[model samples]
Target: MGRYFRRKLLIYGVTFVIAVSINFAVPRLMPGDPVARMLSRNKVANPESSEAMRAYFDNVFGFDVPLWQQYLNYWAALFKGDLGVSVYAFPASVSSVIAGALPYTLALLLPAILLSWIVGNSLGAMAARNKWLDNGVLPVGYVFTAVPYMWLAILLAWVAGVILGWFPVAGGYSFALTPTFSWVFIVDLVHHWFLPFLSLFIVALGGWAIGMRNLVIYELESDYANYLQALGAPRRLVRRYAFRNAMLPQITGLAVALGMVVGGALVTEVVFAYPGLGSLLLSAINNQDFFLLQGILLFIVIGVLVFNFLADVVYVLVDPRTRLGLEGGQS
Candidate 1:
């Protein structure tokens, strides 16, 4: 087991390095100069002042350095836990910018993914048993899964926010209120959160439900199920066994879904002007904020790799076949 984990760790480490290198390379390869954009936005009129500003920006943004040297410096800074200051949000560290947006993204995504998976799996498992439920819920599940996430978000915003005026159409909270721990602030936060959360939850639920239903049905019809039935095992016991076994794939799916939470729900944020990483990411791109973009991508990469590693460990623990293979290899 130790050997297997060491091997996995080594692989993950290599993948992380490669992913980081790619993330660093992409922004540099893109067209347009970030320094130029910053100056343009600032609009320095006098040529001497413009020249002074240009040189200052060049020094601040490391445009004065050679490409190879900049790349090396990037790695060194990263090792020292420096993500650099945001070019667009000048004077603000990349870490701080990302930190500010992290909460909204998490608040929007975590509940959506978790609740959807739990509800979907339960409903799907039940659907396999009751034909009436299977007939009724399956179509609804299909519609939810098939709908585009952004499209659903827009529809919900229009119907609920625009027409019914049930919720705020945009922003993480009411702009009129200051952020605080008071009940008023909390209520406003949930009011704005509902549409985005619902869009994600409703969309994700169908996929989980459909996948679980099929897996449960298959497990019930598998040879082991028949053998247990022939031996007169109680229906509940047989079903309990099948359900436990059927959960393996869902466990894996859950991990991937969780891993994606950091990068997930981009469209929903865009639609609602939610104060999250997705909105921040758009701003970063528009202004060619390389450091900020790199930081966001790095965050996403680490999240995915960490969760994937955990999933592998969990799968080996729960699935006897995987454990047996590793054990046999040691022999």
Candidate 2:
């Protein structure tokens, strides 16, 4: 267990370094200057002639420094928790910008992820049990899963928000209510959250359903499952022992999925105009807000790494053979 934890921590550390490097390198590799992008957004006379702008951009963006020095500075800032200021939302730190938008993302994503787990897994298990259900569900699920998430969001928005008028068309909350930390605020928040949740829920559920059903089916054929059947084990025992073990991979997938829920729903958030990290990321990219973009990407990378590490630990626990292998000798 000690060695296993050490291995996990070492992997995470290596992953973190790679993530940070990519966060810095990818933007620099892309065409166009960050400074120019920032200047373009401003309405200024003789935008190219300002010495102050030149100095600020050169110094802050490291345009004046050696490439290696700039890379070192970038790594230094990570230690200092200085993600730099947003080019668009100028003077505001990227961290603060992300913090402001995270609530809406959580509000939008939490229910969607939860509902997907409950409904999708249940549907998958039922389908796995019934041959007819398996035949019908696999095709329908494949169709839904194959559909682009943004298209689904739009289709649902029009049908539910416009035609039925059951949910809001766009935005995180009503413009009328001032954001506060009171009961009235919470109620308004939930009311506003409904539409985005429904949209994401519909789109996100398919993968889990298909994954779970396949897992359950595969487990049903295992030697232990056959043994249980021969022993006339209770149906519940057969499922709990055999099918549950089969579903371990899906649970690991769920952990990865949950980690991504924080950062991967950018398109959905953009379509809905919901104020979240996803929307923030979209705006940052379009406007070339490099600092904010880097911060968001780093956040996502770290989140995924942490979740993956957790999944590895869970994987070992679920299958003791994994732990035995990691211990470097036969059990």
**lDDT by residue for model 2 (145-200), tens:** 88887888788789988898887768777888888888987886776677677767
Residue pairs of candidate 2 with colliding backbone atoms: none
Supply the TM-score for candidate 1: 0.95
For TM-score, the strongest prediction is 1
lDDT per residue for candidate 1 within 277-305, as digits (tens), equals 99999899999999999999998888889
Runs off by more than 4 Å, candidate 1? none
Scored by lDDT, the top model is: 1
Each model's TM-score, in the order given?
0.95, 0.91
RMSD of 1: 1.5
| Candidate 2 global CA lDDT score | 0.79
Relative to the unseen true structure, what is the C-alpha lDDT of residue 26 in candidate 2, on a scale of 0 to 100? 85
Off by over 4 Å in 2: 46-49, 131-136, 262-264, 323-331
